[model samples]
Target: MAVTLKAEKREDLNKSVTKQIRESGYVPSVVYGKDKESKTISVNSIELVKTVRDEGINAIMSLDIEGEQPVNVMLYDYQKDPLRDELLHADFYMVNMAEEMDVEVPLHLEGEAQGAKDGGVLQQPLYQLQVRSKPADIPEAITVDVTKLEIGDTITVADLPEAAEYEFLDTEDTTIATVVPPDTVSETDEASDEDAEPELVGADGKDEE
Candidate 1:
């Protein structure tokens, strides 16, 4: 179910007006979509933050605009105050339920890798996955199990399990995770120390041959 968020249309584009809106605990936002005229609006800051916190960033929203029919939207982008870390502005994109869209979904790794347990370093190269699916079919996240991975083994995009709901956009050769042998810096340092010659010291604390 889409979360409902109330919004009010704003006609004034004055800088002072935008400042006042922020001061009044509202975030100035714009709603837009293909083939539709963009609308400027304002939403309650507290409610907007709470909604996004409860729902993932990709959660569909029912934007209830005053004097207009409610529309389905997704939070497209946002800006925050660099110093205060407060939300300053937001952008919502209206989405068609039947139309396919490209989005980035969070990627999660589950289970400890066998290679890591055996002293190998496990690395995740990709933290998010590009996926294409309809609005209703979009997944909250994609998880890959790493329990079977061995040293020098890699999990690529092609290694992922097939899903009917969404399609991965990344090329099959793109690596997601891998396990490799641990760094040998300590062994190299030990060898270097063993090969070094001790320097003779003089009474003045200077190196002498």
Candidate 2:
């Protein structure tokens, strides 16, 4: 499901104009494509964020323009205010139904890792990956099972599930996540770790003395 938002034409194009627009509760944005020329537009920051909140950032959108043609696009760049955490701007890229489009889908790790059961730390490196597939066949998130992953176990890019239309753009060497074993504590290690004795030498600070 897509959240539909209402937008109006924005005539301002400069930085000052954009700041003013954002102050007025609007997010400045643009829509462009290989087939058409670039367009400047704006949306309500609150509504726009809400529309993309439930769905992932890469979720497909149906943009409803007032009088112009309805456009199908995916949310691209969304700029935010670092200090205030405000939505400042957005960008949309046109989607073609005929061609295979490359997109990044969020990876969702499922199940407690077996390594974790053994007091090992589970680390997931890749957050999202670029996959080529049709818009309709695109998935919101890719799920990876981590139950069998033990210490030193790695799930590479090749380990991901396969879909007929999707193609991975990353190298096979890319590591998605892994588990590391916890270091064992020993009596000797604890004694040596905390106690340090300083050797005194006559008029010199040297072990040779």
**Best by the lDDT measure:** 1
- lDDT of candidates 1 onward, in order: 0.91, 0.80
TM-score of each: 0.85, 0.81
Candidate 1 residue spans exceeding 4 A from truth? 184-209
- Candidate 1: C-alpha RMSD to true structure equals 11.7
What is the C-alpha lDDT profile of model 2 across 44-144, one tens digit per residue? 88878887787767777777766787787888887777667888778888788678887888888999999999888888889998888887677778889
Candidate 2 regions off by >4 Å? 14-16, 184-209
Clashing pairs in 2: none
| Per-residue lDDT of model 1, residues 35-58, tens digit only | 989999999999999998888778
**Among all candidates shown, the one with the greatest TM-score:** 1
Residue 154 lDDT (model 1)? 97
lDDT computed for candidate 1: 0.91
Model 2, TM vs. native: 0.81
Model 1: pairs clashing at backbone N, Cα or C within 3 Å: none
